[model samples]
Target chain A: MNRTFRNMLLTLCTISLMAGLSWADTLKVGVQAPITGSYANEGQGIENGVRLLASQINAAGGVLGKQIEVIPCDDQGTAMAAAICAKDLVNKGVSMVIGSYTSTCAQAAQKTYFNAGVIQTSDGTADSLTENGYWTFLRNSFPNSAEGEFAANYMVNVKKYKRIVVLSDFSTYADGLGNATEAAIKKLGGNVVSRDKIKADSQNFTPVLTNVKSKNPDVIFFAGYYSDGGQLRAQQMALGIKADFIGGDANDNPDFIKLAGSAAEGAFIINVPSPDVLPYPIAKSFIADYQKTYGEMPPSIWGLMNIDGMRAIIHAMEQNKSFDTKKAVDYLHNLQTPIDGITGPIAFAKDGNRKGGAYVVKKIQADGTYFNEYVQ
Target chain B: MDIFLQQLANGLTIGSMFALVALGYTMVYGVMKLINFAHGDMVAASAFVGLTIYTQIMGQAASLAAVIVIFLLTAAVMACIGIILERVAYRPLREAPRLSAVVSALGASLVIQNGIMLIWGPRMKIFPELVPQVYWDFGGVVISLIQVIILALSLFLMVSLYLFVEKTRMGAAIRASSIDQDAARLMGINVNSIIMIIFIIGSSLGAVGGLFIGLYYRGITFNMGWQYGLYAFIAAIIGGIGNIPGAMLGGMLLGLFNAFIAGYISSTWADAFTFILLILILIVRPTGLLGERVAEKV
Candidate 1:
């Protein structure tokens, strides 16, 4: 061949390679999390779980023959930031999104993602989240109402606590759970002696605990994050309030045990089946792999749920052979078989909240670790 | 009555932490006449230093000696940080416009908070429980060993601070410099060294408060500086801005008020009530409870 012809051939080859590099048909999944603020731990934990699952899916020959790319958008754990993150992700043309540790953030992002016709799933469990009539939004976590009802029944039926004090951090999520729990307890003929709302960053729980002590409640139900819950437990012990402290999903973190220390003993937390307790080989191996990869157990069950939620989304995409938002939404909403999640079997209701998601009432044992008392 | 007693005890416990942190704010304001916004971040930084020493360096064998060692190490290290912060972030801006110095303090606050976030990865850490679990029961009102220690230590430090400010030569220099920097310098007082000494004392006190909070709550987040810092600033303002005794008084009063409101009214309204009180106080007496209206008071 002539020198000019040879050079042209080389240029053509380079063009093809560049085309393959630039337009490789990768599926982009946006991960929205508060990765730079006080709630960064929870958001980071969720991102880790999703990233790990994405790697696993890619290793298994990718989803729908396309390489999975998980892009994280830090929302700083604020509703405003979350909305901006949602808009940015939609602008980036991501196929799907996993997000938002708090319900308020999820709700904030819902309008943006819904308007853009992008699929988004959250671990936040606020009941009204699914009621927003957004086809694009789904929650893999169970509702706050469910968890609250479960907790109330446990307190009234199992422990037979007649007088209870319900306390929340006054966030939408915490207040919803606290209200539901109080209503449930009252419905079951249990007296809600007092109800109080505390600030999310409250350092002192003495006044609230003192008031509860005066009420002589048999149990104190706290609906808030581990920071508040753990400190509340410690302060309650300090103030000689012997009432057992029970809390919602936010209590399902290692930080709670660490902060509460000896006070965490006998405290009950409503949680999903942690990966360690999942009887499935898939879950057991996931836990083992997580430990090997991350050097610790998953921080909370929400981490495992994020993995399963992403898995379900990917499975739906594979079944439909399309990244079209409407198709994926329909597939997820009509998921006939439950996805075998690391936590447990996860199915979705028509409203997009997780259906048949098993909750477990776990007690913090004397060994400073949680043990599943019973599955609900 | 039992509830009132319990709330009071709780208020005092939290009040001691506020007073300790308020001393840092007031002292810096007294000497430099500049609000050190980074004062609260120093608490967080010191707590993390103490936490690192206790958990990573000292390991599981931490005892009373370990606690004391960690406390001293944190205080010393944070004092050094205060010196460096003053030298790098504040001293150059010292001769600049007063607003520039204030802006620099705010910038320093952001840098410290975000720097901590970068180092610690924005995760909340559980401080090692150094104080043993023991409670003194008074019928329905109980107090823990940690609370007692916090109260006693704060009282000792406040008393020492009072005596040092009133009696010591360094304290005299600090007071003189606060009155007139040029006059103090002309009087053979090394104003720069006195300023550094003030930073040292303030930073150490802030560290002690931070360490106590970490032990009491057993949780520390990087941004905790802002929360505690805001409260300390409020207390300082309420007690009469740069007045040391006023800061102590403001801290106790604020704590008691917070506890009472939360106990009697609503915990959700506690913070709102606090701000309302601040607004009311400002409206009623802009000079604060102990602040002087005349310029010669400084």
Candidate 2:
């Protein structure tokens, strides 16, 4: 009786092993990020999100009833490395690509993906990306230009600042953000005392900070990634400069708190609305299901968008009921299905932009990051 | 005026970092006939070791004493690594062709840097700010307490180093090795040990550089050493390769040059100016300010 039971267990194990091997040949989604360099913290979320989403999709009977495989590439968070990932992905035969943690990197990869006729979804929303118009290229993340306008409006209209200062990294994204924000501030009857671009890796902005302090600007809008943002925040507060730090999405990370410590307590930053998953049952269910399967809520906005990007592609494939690239693009262009996504009310506009219902204001709080409901 | 003073202070603070890192480069080149390309990354590795102690085993409340203990432990470990690199990777090729030795050092550098990334991770973490930044003014110039301390410490270290090399027997033997390796070896000196000693001392200097970088920047990415390392190398070259005082001059000059460019020249041209200065200097003085053309013996 014991020998017979052991033989039966061995037979069951072989069958499961066979199933695992076949799982290797499932649908592949290539994910890219700056996993090898200075921007790795930011990149970590973007890469992990692709896998998190892929697992979710695969669990739902897979895409086209086939399991999903997430293939990730490291771009080291640099532009040049991102381009290489694009080329490498195309050769690897991934149908669509999700990538690029920074605008600089997205800019480089967009060209490569477009030329290769491969599809791409990016989190970095540099304005120059709009000109490409690759039907295959789509950015779910709002551009920094929009962020700039929103930040400026909030400072002048809500805070009622008389004079504002602008400090931007010389990145294409930050510069566009700074320029648009500067215009917004002036339109609101606010004067710009100082506008300067600091080096991306600059350790100190005391020169710029001091000048602004001397001018006594009511508020300062800093446009840069979290690395520089945190340092500037710490130094500004440490030196007794009282200007409020207003920045865009790059400041949306826990690392900012780690760098600035107590100095970051009252700092303000602008970001698109993450669906208030707590209050809304639909969004809460999505988060619950995600955590049950993957063990954590999507850490950053990129996780939800990446999952949404995969769903968009999979939804398109189901509509056409095939793996054709053009068919997928057509489905994305005319996405009409009221898919209940984790981010709420998923639908695309004519120009491939997420509908206005999306973009919400989030505030960093002591307990957890909070988002204000959009009152449109 | 407040902004100008602040920027000036910022420049000096960063200059202090360059000075510390520059010492490692200057000293190694001064004592050995080779540049330890791995010095900067060794600093990075030590910081990671320090960080591992803080966030992992020790927990958040790791005391000031614990932090210092970890730092010294890391420094000692890094010293051993530096000595080993000199012994195994470098000493074998010391008598070989110059190009081969330089290439070997470069290869060692790449290995050490990438090895750290593989072992730890590539993600940037917020390093604990070990010291607080406060301010004082001298002659109407704003200076942060941290910056003043950094400057003062660097000056003290450099002076002590100068005195040791001028007065001590080991320092004299190290100097003699650089001047004439064969002569020192024949003079009943352990030439290899002196070279190892130079590396250990230089690596400790790099550890100091790394600690300062962690505190001042308050964030450390895996690749933090590359750009800073390159800049220090440029400072070393500009000061006159293998010259101690020259490295100091180069670091100060580079810092002042960058601050002036950002302040006076268009801020957009700040990055372009550094390269332009390097190119112009290269054209004018290929061997740098105080470098001498040494004849080779076949």
- Give the winner by lDDT: 1
Correct interface contacts retained, every candidate? 0.81, 0.60
Fnat, model 1, is 0.81
Off by over 4 Å in 2: A1-25, A274-282, A285-297, A357-376, B1-4, B56-59, B62-67, B133-142, B282-286, B290-298
Per-residue accuracy of model 2 over B223-285 as CA lDDT, tens digit each: 677777877888888888887777877877777666767766555786698788888887888
Model 2, residue pairs in steric clash:
A34-A77, A211-B3, A273-A360
After superposition, candidate 1 runs with Cα above 4 Å error: A1-24, B295-298
Chain A TM-score values, per prediction: 0.91, 0.85
Local distance difference test values of all predictions, in order: 0.86, 0.73
Looking at model 1 chain A, report the run of 10 residues with the lowest lDDT sum. Answer: A18-27
